[model samples]
Target: MVRLMPRKGERGNALLVLYSALIYLFLYLPIAVIILFAFDAKPIPGLPLNGLTTSWFAEALRDEKLVGSLLTSLRLAVISAALSTALALPAAMVLAWLPIRFKSLVMSMVLGPVVLPQLVLGLGLVILLRAAPDMVGEPAIILAHTTITSSYATLILYSRFLGFRRSYIEAAMNLGASEFTVFREIVLPLIRPALISVFMLAFTDAFGEFVVAWFVAGFTETLPITIWTSLRQVISPKVYALSSVIIIVTLLLSLVSQLWVIRQTRLTSKAPSA
Candidate 1:
């Protein structure tokens, strides 16, 4: 019995390690290939990864369509993030402090997109907006992005607001501070990081979102949609270059969020109690 128990324990540990490695490999193996192929000198993906080349990266940068697509994507992201933040701030503030009984219901409505499939949402929007052709441009893109990102913005900012010290406002009021003054001096600074985080999220998602933007802006192609077009019928190594750029930028953003920007959101060392 003792010998059997020892053998079982050893097998369990071995299985655990093997499973862990397999999971990681499954997750990263494709990404590793993408990175590897991005640098390959060959025009084709699989053949002769002999030497690395800077030419692909240069072509990616210089491609007029790619450049235009990048600019359009940036514009879409900026507009989306800005609109989302603008709409979410007041909504979140009310949600945090208002004495509404159906708070859960309201929250579900706000956070609906988190569960909803992006494709379904996109297709639905397309059907609904099919009657209105005039709304396809920056305005349509902005509205779609706002709808998609507002919930995220609200949730993030509201979570921060939950831990906020209301007494600071009370104390200021007791000392005859104006409502406007208290909000400006206290509330805004405290929620700044939350706003920034939401903005970043909104922009990132908007820039990469293929389906919704494609549907919402029928004639107007944001960068992702354009990139898809470039990829499909007219595939090229330039796509690899663009993919490489996207991967690098995304990785950098993730690093910044994890290491610098989010860490700057110091919750523990908050303002002193009232």
Candidate 2:
């Protein structure tokens, strides 16, 4: 019996698929390992698979310090993400559409936090906060996270606005719509998906940030700080359990944000009927 040989194009496609699969596996295998160990009955995480158990998750939830820190992180991340998005919106609009001198300098300044080392940024913020001791706890952490996350928010919105149709705004103006009305009715609706995506990304970044938060945290504890403290002593399986929860939540948020963007793109791509 004669066997059919695959064409060169088929071999190339197969290789490309295999290459992509390997890359994804490399990136995600460590995360999978952590999730697996979180459910493993083995007290110390390692090879030789132990029976699966959910006790670690319960223990993590029951730990007052861990739970409290998780809540604090949630609160901080929400406030920071909101504040960052709020600040970034106007800045991105200006950068994307407005004609201003020294625009490059302004952009660089806005993005400084993202490029600067977190340790140095933390130190700088610590020094700045010295005068105001009252803001050394949650307030300080929120401010620091906002400063860092705003840069990313700005970048995302700026890119979105760069491709935005200015004709919409001009048409609104011709129809006697005020700038505020135009923004609220026109720009806001178009960019809502981008805004939501930026907020989700900022929230995830702030939630996981530890270095700057550690510097300005003072007596305040976040989940990352708590995990770091736990790591100093004997590591607990509960830490892994908590981490798995965070990873799962982050993945969900990311997936939702991506889907939102994709859906919006599809909806926008269809031309309006005559």
Candidate 3:
């Protein structure tokens, strides 16, 4: 028996795989540690696991403040994600398919939040909300999250819209379908998966967000804010348990969105030639 030497391309591929594995290890090792420590019997999170126990999760679940914050975070994420997706859809369609003036300028404005630092954006929002002091808590947080997440949603939707088949719209119109009818029956159905993907992405981002939410929350306490405040003093194992749960949820959402995007892309590629 003999082993064959790898070709240059094979060698390059192996190196790429190794590099990707290292990157993933670096990213997920800490998360793995946190999840492991969440179940540790020890009060403090560290190496050399002291017995395994699910008590931390139960403790976390029993905390009224943590439960309330989780609920608030979920509510905020849902509202912001829905609002961002709704606002982005029409804007993305127009920007991707229509011949509008100052298209670049409009796009720049839409994507401005992505480029702006979160701290700067939060400060700006805080200053702007000074006029409406009543809007400080949940309102301000929702608005800020929507603004930031909408940029991402718009970018995702814009790409999806750009790849859309105009022939479908034209054929529907030729059959005497109104523009709105065409959009409702054809465009929406075709891009539904992309919409879901964008919505999920927005929700996950808003759920995990901290800086902007911190600045605008005022008296509101979302999950991230609660976690931050907890970290200011002694860290609790319950917080670790909560964080592990959040990490799992976020990963699941992201995985679903990515799979949806991949499926949508495949379907798009399989569309019949015009």
Could you say which candidate leads in TM-score?
3
lDDT of 2 by residue, 61-175 (tens): 9999999999999999999999999999999999999998998898889889999999999999999998998999999999999999999899999999998888888988999
TM-score of each candidate structure, all chains considered together = 0.86, 0.92, 0.93
List lDDT for all candidates, in order: 0.81, 0.92, 0.91
Clashing pairs in 1: none
**Local accuracy of candidate 1 as per-residue lDDT tens digits, 170-266:** 8889999898998898778767777777888898988888877877776776778877886677456677777778888888887877665556556
Candidate 2, which segments miss by more than 4 Å at Cα? Answer: 1-15, 271-274
Give the lowest summed-lDDT range of ten residues in model 3: 265-274
Q: Give the residue spans of candidate 1 off by over 4 A.
A: 1-24, 267-270
Which pairs clash (backbone N, Cα, C closer than 3 Å) in model 2? none
Q: Candidate 3 has which clashing residue pairs, if any?
A: none
Per-residue lDDT tens digits for candidate 3, residues 192-240, read 8889988888988898899999998999999989989988987899999
